[model samples]
Target chain A: MGIFYFVAFLSVFFALMTIFTKNPVHSVLYLVITFFTFTVHYILLNAQFLAVVNFIVYMGAIMVLFLFVLMLLNLNKDTEPMKSTLVKVMGAIAGMCLLATFLGAFRVLEGQNEYVTGNTDVGLVKNLGKVLFDEFLLPFELSSILLLTAMIGAILLAKKETKQG
Target chain B: MEGAFILEKLILVVVVFTVTLVIAMYSTLAERKIAGFMQDRYGPDRAGIFGILQPLCDGGKFFFKEEIIPAGAHKTLFILGPVIAIITACISSAVIPWGQDLVINGRTVSLQVADVNIGVLYVFGVIALGVYGIMLGGWASNNKFSLMGAIRAASQSISYEIGMGLSLIALLMVTETLQLGEIVAQQSGFVNWNIWVQPLGFLIFITCAFAECNRVPFDLPECETELVGGYHTEYSSMKLGLYMFSEYINMFVSSALMATLYFGGYNFPFMYDLGLSQNWITIIGVLVFFLKIFGFIFFFMWIRWTLPRFRYDQLMNLGWKILIPLAIANIVLTGVITLIKDTYFQ
Candidate 1:
């Protein structure tokens, strides 16, 4: 539980640092760290497959793409335009309101029976594969088809644009 | 009793760590010696007999050399780059089954560090993370050449990783498991090895592995004639040494992985008939595993010296157009074969 809290703290801290950092590259690096901490949380929950997938997909591939774009754009603090104080104040207020909404939702759940947790094997690859294939097969297949279509569309659009240029 | 168990695990970890370092160190020497021999010349025999102590000399040279950080470089990320590189390289060994279990005092101790169920995926994850070290180092160098090299490396790795994963999928289809130890156990005899069954898959896998390691002829990222030392151009002293060392370590780990995945790992023919004790059998298995890994390492070095470096566009084309499609075809072939076998033979 202590390790959980420490990891949670790190996740939140790095998430904030992702936004607060002046350099875009540093911000991306911080975001990667945030994702890494979340991976740790997944491991703690015994979802080793999910943890490894999260590490590979998000922190590895996605973040590398993010860093690639950031490096190419060459964005720095000096080039960043400043926001108005009014905008900052309004953003803070909006954030606080969202936090209040989340807290209220949790408060409503506090009086109910505590969350049930067992069957740790559910997170294992074999069990997860069985559930995904047996129960959620249709939805899984449908989602994969959707992703494939999106990928093809993206490729076609990019190719057309390049040819015209 | 738990304390003893933990102590055993700790000792295994330490041993694995030291062995990886020693192998990586010698790999450099072997690479040089082999390269020289191939070119009809004597290699570094100055440091010790057969230049065995060359790695030590290299280590001392790195330590005594002056460290440099470019004025415009990001100080923190610059240092973090090599640290990330070496850490990712070292951690990859955790999932590899070094040998069969050693039985002592009625306790069976596995040679691997962590027998994670998703062993293959863990290796993939660590290899994928390896790009960060090169990318970060290159970007932080604040040099155009370094940035270009980093981009090349990142793109090349990402592209080849697709082919590598696809090739592995065919093997996984055959084995029906992701655990490294389980995969090894399944291939107990010479004929049971996955290589004979999925030869095309092995070819594609080994090709992608070469590209993923940024080795020749796929080493476009650090093409010395073009990139001026590539990502490590601005690096000096031990930071540079760490990056170089990490590459060799990555090679060692990848060789071990290839051996484990396709070459039957620590298995030998008719070992049970020899009438050896379990511990002795396991010891022989470990030795055989090392022999396979060393063979693969030597293969890597041989190809490095023999093949000419790929042109950047040629590398990309081979990765995406050739290797990826070949891997996908291997998967289809494996599936068809498996279906036919199940329907007719069973």
Candidate 2:
């Protein structure tokens, strides 16, 4: 649970860093970190399949393409990056205040009931299949259509634009 | 069964992280050895006794090294990229069942850290997100080569994922289960191996695995001859190490998957008939699972040395035109067979 919190915090911190960076490259890097932490979060949630898929599709595949695109464009370091010492200082103060307030309200942690760790039967692949086919079938089919559209969109965009001139 | 407290899960999570990190350390050693042999040379012989301690030495070197921030880089992403890559690799093994229950002192203990249902789908969803880490690293590096590598990785993964998923659908249709343990259980004998029943699906899976793991022929993004170490070109020290190590770790996971889904994970011939105690059976199951994983890892290394890579379009063609349709046909054929057997034979 502590590790989960750590991962969540890292995810938030990196996500913010990714957004705040003036350098696009830095933004991408932090985003990568964000994805990684999210993978950890997925693992904590007992989503083994989700965690690995995160690596395969997101980190290994998508991120690599993102890097290639960035490199091809050569969007090197930002000329003048955003956020300064003054802004950072103010942010720190705001963050600490938020943290303190949250801590002040965290006494509810003691009153929370525990959750029993149950058998592995529930999370097994069989039950998941049933759920997907029975409950999630429509969404699943819709997503397939969405994916097809995305594939076509990517292909169309990637096609070579002729030099009319 | 334990008390319903975060403590059990918390400890389990920590254990998973630690085990993954440990596996990461050894996988480095395996890569070196395989690479060394491929080149027809002795590999890492100088470290502690047959390079058994090479990873430790490497770890020492990385730790002792200086962390240099590139003068013009986005310092934040530069720091974050490696962390993302490493952590993503480490956390992807959570749902993989190491074996059946470990029965000790008249009690049963499960070998897997967590048994979340929807395990397969969860693996897919998480893998889909992992591409972001590489994307960020390349973008953060602010280098042309790194970004190109990342882009290549992203497109390659996205392109093949459809086929990969489609390939698995047939297996899902057959097993009707998403639990990895159940899959293993279903394939509990040599004859029951899904590889025989779902040969085409297995073929698609193995092919997609090479791409998923970014191995050669499909290793275009990281092809040194072309992209110069691909996305991690600008990365050095532990960050670079994380990118490299994650590849092998992913392969490890994929191996476990290949074994579990097709080869009957942890189910050796006559595994049940051994008449061993449940505890012994559990231990044996874990051993069998690791054996299968190692065999796959070896196959990965072996193939890396044997095959040249496919051009990008060719790779896409294989996944889209070849694999997807083939998987669909296989599913249809299997359905027909099952129907015929159910109706006529019965």
Candidate 3:
């Protein structure tokens, strides 16, 4: 329980830091830490496969790509556009409204929240594989197809604009 | 019992850590000596007989040299780069099965530090994380060449990782387990090695391993004629040593992985027929595993000296077009064959 609270605190803190940091590279680094905390959470849930996949796909590959782009762009304080006073005031107003909505929702659901204490071993690879293949087969296949389509779309967009007659 | 278990694991961790570091240190000397032999010259023989003490001298030099951080560099991440590199390198060894269990005073002690169920994916994750060290060091250097090298490395690693994963999937189908110890156990006699079954997968895997390690033929990230010392351009002293040292460690780890995966780790021919005791068998198995690791290391160096580095376009094409497709085909083939055998032979 203590470990869960500490990790939760770290995730929220790093997520906030990701938004607040001035440097783009540092912001991405903070986001990486946020993802790492999520990985820890998955491990705490006894989902080792999910934790490792999250580590590899998010923190490893996706974050590297993020840093790669940021490095290439070489953005600095000088290049950052100054925001108008009106925009800042508008942003703060929007944030306060969102917070109010969250608080109201939590108030409504206060006593109804329930902890899920089910079969913990369902997260193990063998059990997870069986569940995914037997019960969730359609969704699993659909997700792979979706990913393939997205990949093809990316390749098309990245292709050179060929000269036409 | 719990205290003894903890102590046993602690001691195993220390031994594995020291062995990894020593092998990495010697690999540096071995690489240079191999390079010299290939080029028809004597390599660093003055440090000791056959340059045995050369790595120690190199370590001393790195320590004595002045450390430098560029004025424009990110101070925090500039120091964090090599530290991450060395940490990720050392941690990957935790799941590797060094040998069969050794009984010490009737306490059956496993040679592996941790036999995690997802050992293979853990290795993959660690290898994927390795690029951060290069990318961070390069970007933080605040040099154009460094940034270029870092970008190249990131793309190369990302590209090769897919093929590596696919090839492993084929091997997994054959072995039917994710545990490294189980995989090694499944390959018990001479004829049951994975290489014989999945030759194409092994080829794709070894090629990707070379790319992952940034060895010769896939070493465009550190190409000297370009990039100017690559990602470590602005690094000085032991910081620079850490980067180079981590590469050798990565090499050692990769070689061990290949041996364990395809070449039958810690398993030898006709071992059961020799009538040896369990303790002797375990001892010999450990030695055999190290021998296989050394052989793979020599092969890495041999290729490094023989082959010229690949062009960036060539590297990308081989990774995406050739290796990935081949790996996928190998997976399909393995699946079909397994299905047919199950139906017909049963």
Sort by DockQ, top down from the best: 3, 1, 2
Model 2 CA deviation exceeding 4 Å by range: A1-165, B1-16
Clashes within 3 Å, all models in order: 0, 56, 0
For residues B1-346, what per-residue lDDT tens digits would candidate 1 score against the true structure? 8998899989999999999999999999999999999999999999988888999999999999999999999899899999999999999999899999998888899988888899999999999999999999999999999999899989989998899999999999999989999999999968899899989989988998998888889887788999999989999999999999999999999999999999999998887889999999999999999999999999999999999998999988998899999999989999999999999999
Q: Per-chain TM-score of chain B, candidate 2?
A: 0.93
- The per-prediction i-RMS, to one decimal, reads 0.6, 5.5, 0.6
Q: Write model 2 residue lDDT over B13-68, tens digit each, in one string.
A: 78767766676688778877988988999888888888998988998887677766
- Most accurate candidate by TM-score: 3
Off by over 4 Å in 3: A81-116
Off by over 4 Å in 1: A81-118, A160-165
The candidates' DockQ values read 0.74, 0.28, 0.77
Give lDDT: candidate 3, residue B290.
Answer: 96
DockQ of 3: 0.77
Candidate 2 residues A100-152, lDDT tens each?
98887776554553322443333334455566788889998999999999989
Candidate 2 docking DockQ:
0.28
Q: How does candidate 1 score on lDDT?
A: 0.92
What lDDT does the true structure give each of the candidates?
0.92, 0.77, 0.93
Residues B1-346 of candidate 3 have per-residue lDDT tens digits of 9999999999999999999999999999999999899999988899889989999999999999999999999989999999989999999988999999898898899989889989999999999999999999998988898888889999999999999999999999999899999999988868989999999999999999999998998988888889888888999999999999899999999999999999899999887889998889889998999999999999999999999889999999999999999999999999999999999999
Candidate 3, residue B106: the lDDT equals 88
